[model samples]
Target chain A: AQSVTQLDSQVPVFEEAPVELRCNYSSSVSVYLFWYVQYPNQGLQLLLKYLSGSTLVKGINGFEAEFNKSQTSFHLRKPSVHISDTAEYFCAVIPVYNTDKLIFGTGTRLQVFP
Target chain B: DTAVSQTPKYLVTQMGNDKSIKCEQNLGHDTMYWYKQDSKKFLKIMFSYNNKELIINETVPNRFSPKSPDKAHLNLHINSLELGDSAVYFCASSQVVTGDNYGYTFGSGTRLTVV
Candidate 1:
């Protein structure tokens, strides 16, 4: 069984400032990591993913995440955030050799203040 | 164009009533899934179908039933609606079974309210 943990439930950051959302996972085998963004009253949209090769993965809207195997961490980061960036972000994981099911974290609410 | 689409964007029904939410994917993916997001915004997988075959069935109650007429369409029917069933239901599709680059494309989501 695999489980995902998102430490922060809510993160408040100012516009044009940097932000980071912490995510960690626990799995016996290799797993795929993903970040999804959910706007108000909408479904989730894939932000980025860490499959293999390169620890640093870049995604849409200038979002990026670094995968650290030792720490079992895949932290999402953005150099500069905008008001439109405010949304609920979810961190999910899928075991490589197991079922197609995805294990998701509780979610982190990002509030980008002006 | 919407890759995955779900009908009845918002549904408000009385308790003990029965309802169904339809989902269709235009991405031509082999697998489709239904997930429920509660008031706390926690997303949990309810069921998964691959090529019209039931593959994954989580701990969801027996009141929830998922039907797949074909690979492109998966519909969810609730037998007896309850207040706990009120949440945002999303339909998603994916190509890869597991591992990296295997990400899902989600629908707009259907908000179900049981009054």
Candidate 2:
């Protein structure tokens, strides 16, 4: 079974500081990667997704993630973040061939302190 | 306008009671799914329906039943709810045309609290 691992449970950062949320998946088959953000008491919103494209994928709200095939990592990055960026971020993956189901990692709470 | 919406944004019921969380989608998507988010915020897929057909049913308990009246609606009915069933349930929908950039549009979750 394909699984996603998000090592960090919580990450605290100051506003305007850069941040990186690491995500790794256990799948040798081709897969589609995605990042979703959830505000307090809100639904999950898509931040970005990596289909079959370049390694670096830019998402909304000045967030970007790089898909490293060799390392099996798709780490999300933001050069500078705002207090509004504070939310629970989830990393998800679905195998290319079997795209019916999405496996999500335990979310990482991004606490952007002002 | 909301793409996906679940009713009873907050539901509080006693144990052994039966409750249902209604979900509907206006996105004209072909696939809809139910996901459960635990207290620790770990999400796991419970059920998925595609074009009104059952596709993915995880290792969820038999007490939980999912009904799809159409491709646009997927409602979850829980019987004999237990304290462990207290969690946020999310409803999502996707078009799944080619599945290249597959992503779901989720509804504002229904927070269920079983007392």
Candidate 3:
């Protein structure tokens, strides 16, 4: 079984300011991680995913996330945020070598202010 | 061209009513899924179909049913809906041949409101 937890329910930040949205997961075996963003009343869009290899993964719209095996976390980070970046972000996981559907976290709402 | 599309973008219905939402994908993928996002913004997988076969069915209520007439089309129907059934339903498609069949293209979503 696998599960994901997004630490922050809501994050308020100023424009051009750096921000981080924390995510952690619990799994009994190896897993694949993903970060998805959803605009208002829209479907979820994949930002990035970590299947293997490097711990650091970059995504579209200037977003990035680092996979920490020790901490069991894949926190999303952006050097600078824009008002357009305001959206709901979700962290999800799928067990490796297992035919399971993606399990998503509660989601974190990023509110970028001017 | 849209990769994934669902009908009834916004549906308003009363309790005990029955409704159906249709989904179609042009991605030529073998697998499709249905997900529900509650008002709390928590997404949960409800059903998945591969090659028009039922693959995964979660702990959804019996009132909810999924039908896949073909690999490219999946439809969801609700019978005797309740107020708690209100949610945003998303239709997604992905390829199954690859290891990471998790690469899903999602539909805009059908916001169903039951009063």
Candidate 1 regions off by >4 Å?
A: B97-101
Tell me the TM-score of each prediction against the true structure.
Answer: 0.97, 0.97, 0.96
RMSD of each: 1.3, 1.1, 1.3
Which parts of model 3 have CA positions greater than 4 angstroms off? B97-102
Look at candidate 3 and tell me the lDDT of residue A98.
58
Instruction: Estimate every model's Cα lDDT from 0 to 1.
Output: 0.94, 0.94, 0.93
Write the residue-wise lDDT of candidate 1 on B28-78 in tens digits: 899999999999999999999999999999999999999999999999999
Model 3 lDDT tens row, B16-74: 99999999999899889999999999999999999999889999998999999999999
DockQ of 3: 0.69
Q: Looking at candidate 2, what is the lDDT of residue A74?
A: 95
lDDT string for model 1 (A43-104, tens) is 89999988889999999999999999999999999999999999999999988775468889
Clashing pairs in 1: none
Q: Is candidate 2 or candidate 3 better by DockQ?
A: 2
Ranking 1 against 3 by TM-score, winner: 1
Each prediction's DockQ against the real complex:
0.70, 0.77, 0.69
